[model samples]
Target: MRHFLTALLVMILTAHIAIAQSQPVLNLELANKIADAAQEKATSENWNVVITILDQGGNLILLKKMDGTQIGSIEVAQLKAKTAFEFKRPTKVFEDMIKGGAVHLNTMPITAVEGGLPIFKDEHIIGAIGISGVTSVQDGIIAEAALKAVSLN
Candidate 1:
């Protein structure tokens, strides 16, 4: 019985070590940098917008909205980032899924719209950032700028 307990502990410890090494750490400073880059991109076009940055688990890390931007944009950007985090894809993908008659869009607490994108580094999802108060294409562009600013391919 002692041997059996020892074996179980070894297996559990091995699994724990593997998981810890496999996981990526997405910190607040990185999230903030992405949000700031996106905000700069959007504002550079004379477009005031709201930006929301979320960690891997879809929790808000940072949120900002330029003055004169619509209040509704704040919630919109948060939802967009959350949607991307949950879906593990760009927010436009949800829009496509909805167009394909994906009923889950209505069922799930998600927005099948634009303005959100996954931040992948070293083939792992680090976080996501979203922008609102602009056109869908512009939103994507701003996100692209942020990704570039972070040098995250």
Candidate 2:
């Protein structure tokens, strides 16, 4: 019985290690890298925008507003990031649903708009990015470019 208990303990520890190893982590450095890429894209297009990054746990990691960007975009950007992180999908999904007559979603606590995207690493979401201060389509484009620049998918 002693030997069996020891084996079980070892198995539990091994499983814990594997689980930890498989989980993805996001930190400030990574968030800055992604925000930089997004800013670059916006600058190249002469579009001032606000960028927001949130960790998987819905914690704000970074927030940036390009020069001349509308101040209102700050909240919009954060809302977009929070919505994406909470839903585990692009905010565009909700936008599309709303356009398809899912108006009920408006009553929910979600920003059903474009410009929010989940940051994926190894098929797992580590964080999310949101852009505002430009057209919805343009914001989405910037977010996509940033993710591609960092090869985060």
Candidate 3:
């Protein structure tokens, strides 16, 4: 019985490791492309926004702050990106949930803002993008534009 239990545990651990290893990792090149796309969108709209790109594990891949953007947006943008990646959904979803009376959601260590979105490719979340220093809706628009660009790649 002891040997059987050990073998079962090994098999379970091996399968978990295999699945994690099979997931694609976000590279600097892709992060740059996403940031550039968001930058271009924000510039075209005359919006000075801070853009943050984060990997699937919620690590910062790249960050860019447009001129005239507020300094506070830097941290806000990073937090937004982290929230999106960690939660595997757009930050707006959390915000909406809280507004609907799920107030306990605020206790979590995440920024439930509309500016953050997960970047998906082939139905898998490859990374995330967050934009700030604009209205929450406008920030979401910029992140969505970046996501679209990433999808086309």
Candidate 4:
């Protein structure tokens, strides 16, 4: 009976370790790296923007606003990041749905615009990034470039 109990304990520990390993972690270092990349891209284009990063649990990890960027973009950036984190998908999905006549999505608690993208590691979402300033398409481009720069796609 002692040996069986010991075996069961080992099995439980192994399972716990496996579950922890399968979950992706997002830390400040990674979030800053992503934000830096986004800033660089926006700067290169001479565009001022606001960037927001959120952890998987919908917690704000980082927020950056370039000089001369509109103040309103701050909230928009946060909303986009929150939407992405909450939905575990890019905000563009909602925009696409709306374009396809899913206007009801606008009434939902989502930004429903481009520029929000989920950050993935090993096919699992770790966090999300959102940018606002220029056009929606341009914001999306900046977010994509940031993800690619960090190799977090």
Candidate 5:
């Protein structure tokens, strides 16, 4: 009877753990809203920047380039967003790591740029946003504002 009770308890715990975790998905409406928020922030700051939004799987959801933004920034922005989504962390984390002598991280398919941020809902990452064409810190600021618009940090 004791062994049966212990096994039953373990099974119950396993089921609870599985039910407690779920992956959130990024939909088109949310992606557009996030991009729009980022663009608005950049405009308010008088910054011509490019914004890219990606789903948690690293698929591009939306891309926006403000007037006068550098053409090269479009690709950079996408790559940054992809890196953030796939790695499940802000691009700044990787940037700081590289700056702190983790130079080997450069060999991976990730960007050590500061403009990318992951978007989370219910403590789960649903997507990411990346901004470019300004100072790295400023770009991050714009992305962060976008994440805030969606109530994600």
Candidate 6:
């Protein structure tokens, strides 16, 4: 009876470990959710903007440049998202650092400009989202909406 109980406990612990390993990471899902929500809000507001989602590794996850948005905005948004993900900081924050004479922005192979935010999940950095076109301020507005939609940081 004692041997059987010990084997049963081991099996249960193994199963739990396997389940934990099988859980999907949150970056992709958060990116898709952010992009979809940004697009929905932009459409309703007639605000043409490019939304970009990038994983923590700076890889593109999703992108949407709304109709009427400038073609160049797409690349800009991508760069912004990539910058935020790679640096794990908001692109605007990097820009501010540059303005403060950080002089480090040039060394990074990323755009340290506005329109990017670190996508957060429970205080963890999962990915990032960026917005462009219209105005820089509007970019923040849309991106914030996306974050709020997903209840992410």
Clash pairs detected, candidate 5:
none
User: What are the clash counts of all predictions, listed in order?
Assistant: 0, 0, 0, 0, 0, 0
Candidate 3: pairs in clash: none
Q: What is the TM-score of each predicted model, taking all chains together?
A: 0.79, 0.86, 0.82, 0.86, 0.82, 0.76
Q: RMSD in Å for candidate 6, one decimal?
A: 3.4
Evaluated with lDDT, which candidate comes out highest?
2
Model 2, stretches more than 4 Å misplaced? 1-16, 20-22
lDDT of each: 0.83, 0.92, 0.89, 0.91, 0.87, 0.80
lDDT per residue (tens digit) for residues 1-153 in model 2: 999999999999999899878777889988999999999999999999999999867799899899899999999999998889888899999999999999999899999889999888878888899999999999999999988888654
Model 4, span 1-153: residue lDDT tens: 999999999999999999877777888998999999999999999999999998866689899899999999999999998888888899999999999999988789899999999887877788889999999999999999999987654
- lDDT for model 3, please: 0.89
Give the least accurate 10-residue stretch of model 2, judged by summed lDDT. 144-153
lDDT of 6 by residue, 65-140 (tens): 7888999998899888877877788888878888899996679787877788887665556678889987777787
Q: Which one wins by TM-score: 1 or 6?
A: 1
- In order of lDDT, best first, we have 2, 4, 3, 5, 1, 6
- Candidate 3 regions exceeding 4 Å error are 1-21
Winner on TM-score between 2 and 3 is: 2
lDDT of 1: 0.83
Deviation of model 5 at 49, angstroms: 0.9
Better of 4 and 6 by TM-score: 4
Give the per-residue lDDT digits (tens) of candidate 3, residues 28-52.
9989988898999998999999999
Cα miss at 147, model 4 (Å)?
A: 0.4
